[model samples]
Target: MRDNEKDLSWWQTFKSVGAAFFGVQSSTNHKQDFNKGKPVQFILVGLVAVILFVMSLVLAVTFVMPA
Candidate 1:
């Protein structure tokens, strides 16, 4: 029934809500790539990126009017 008691109750509810929004759970497993398989993934991604860059360069050069 007191004003100070109401304020303290409000603060506790706010903190509990904030904690639910931001707390980290230790039971969840994080997704990870195994190092043994990483080199192949790296090479594949690199090759695809390089191919895209080269194709873009070719298209730009082919469409530009001669100066």
Candidate 2:
């Protein structure tokens, strides 16, 4: 946590977005995200995470349900 480094890394962005998805993001993190994150990048990452989540659920259901 260096003062010179003000923005989150890609992995940190992903973690922030994931916490947001679960509606449990801390206020401090939210503030940091708003201050340091790029909107388009966050949007793109969020979309990708949502799509992957849906795809995984579909695959799991396909595999588990009696056919």
Best by lDDT: 2
Worst 10 residues of 1 by lDDT: 28-37
User: TM-scores across all candidates?
Assistant: 0.42, 0.84
Error of 1 at 16 (Å): 37
Global lDDT of model 2: 0.90
For residue 65, what is the lDDT in candidate 2?
Answer: 100
lDDT by residue (1-67, candidate 2, tens digit) is 4467577788889999999999999999998998888788798889999999999999999999999
lDDT of 1 by residue, 1-67 (tens): 3334322233333333343335531232111122122344445554665687789998899889575
- Candidate 1 regions exceeding 4 Å error are 1-37
Task: Determine the C-alpha RMSD for candidate 1 after optimal superposition of all C-alphas.
Answer: 20.1
Candidate 1 colliding pairs:
none
In model 2, state the lDDT of residue 45.
88
